[model samples]
Target: MKYLEGIAEFCAVADVGNFTGAANKLDTSVAQISRKVASLEKQLGVKLLQRTTRSVSLTEAGTQYFQQVLPALKVLEDAQLAVSALQASPQGLIKLTAPVAFGEAFIAPLLNTFMQKYSGISVQCTFSNEKLDIVEQGLDLAIRIGKLEDSTLVAKKLATRHLFVCGSRDYFKEQGQPRSIEELKEHSLLVGSQPYWRLFIDNKIQSIPVQGRVRYNSGNALCSAAVAGLGIAQLPGFYVRKALASGQLIELFPEYKDKQEAIWAVFPSNRNVAPKIRLLVDFLAQHLVSDS
Candidate 1:
């Protein structure tokens, strides 16, 4: 336990790149932090840091040591927090980000209920279509839609989203329904974000170039245009489910629908995830369902 004291302090110093910053973060005196690190280096029989007045850097050995030990320290810290959480109620400000339409439609309501249930917690949410780096932005969590790229962050599956090729009933009556993917070239198309429509073809993913008289960045706007009999639009299930049910729009090809994508709650990978983040991820997993 005595040896462990400086391990966290050393990591803090490595993270902030300075003793004063680490000391401030740990709420300890610079002298105490310095002593702890010095003691640790003596015990290890190696110099861990090269310190200067302006900044500090790890030695090559120190870098290797930090890489090896950081994960273990994180595990220990998480264990300690897990024990504490069992005795304490969840309480903290959770900062999260999500896409605009989905956030407004679903996440915001879910958070409202979550806050109501956990009176000690508060939430800060950012709604944007643009993807932002959660770690650099200082966000606790983020809701990601569609395919997730290979990343270091942890992702918890929340729901599934299906893409639908649809057109208004009136448009289909006049322009004729496309019986196959090839026929789409003859009809007026409505597109958003991407220039090509993605669909499952021959048991594989296929991208077909799409051109349209109208284009929109917002899914809602694209759905609205399709509903107004402008053209066929490929949109997410959430954006067009109601219209499909109401007879305002008709699903194009059931057999050639795009592959379903997952909605995920993503956060920085850590051994001891905060209770606020854990609870929220669990809550969404339990409640949120696929729109399709």
Candidate 2:
């Protein structure tokens, strides 16, 4: 049992080919995953991975070890799932928070289904854009987007969100389409809390400082402004998807969309995660549409 400690971590890195992906899959921190895998290599006295800034590759010995262990791990995982499926019905009070728009558009509908499935389970939610300390608030979960402030939190990735730059056809016609990033200076930009917009231009990520006519903390409000032909806005796909599809808004510089951000369900690692909470996260991950 002592020697078996890092096998799962090593296996995860091998399958995902990156520590961050393994961390997401295992619902742990990347540092923890890296430590475990490094410990495993030290124990075996073999260099199993060739790690680079951008990629991870297997050594010849690692390939052989992986080929042998992957099937065994699969069997172990299958057995665990088979056993867990027969456990008691998960029921408890679950408290959580998410971005208002996302919670309203996606999480709320799934929650009704979750409550129906677990008759004894009760739910409470707080929808806000401001970040809250879940552990300090004595909350069970926090559904978050983009960078996580606390690196130690245990997080399971739920979905990917795309930020789209768009404006109404009338707005484009009046202002004239921006042929380049520099041309954006010629028109008004609608923005949120940040004055800088994160975008991919010329195949490189850039954070360009912007001066906008209107600034709102709400993505929904910014999206509406874009639809009203007030200005060009950068909004998440969930906020602008329908508008783009309906031709109410046209995607600007489609080839230069902002990088996708992962939507995560995060919890305090110090607390013992109850079955009810685990099941809820699993349900969300399974039901939420995945990009890959």
lDDT of 2 by residue, 153-245 (tens): 899898887788889999989989898888989999997888887787767778889887799988889988998999998888888889999
lDDT of model 1 at position 245:
92
**Global Cα lDDT for candidate 2:** 0.83
Residue pairs in collision within model 1:
none
Whole-model lDDT per candidate: 0.85, 0.83
Backbone clash total for model 1 is: 0
Model 1, position 60, has a per-residue lDDT of 94
Angstrom error at residue 227, model 1: 1.0
lDDT score, candidate 1: 0.85
lDDT of 1 by residue, 53-138 (tens): 88799999899989989989888877877875886678878888999998999899999999999998999899999887665465
Measured by lDDT, the strongest candidate is: 1
List the candidate 2 regions with Cα displacement exceeding 4 Å: 1-87, 202-204, 290-292
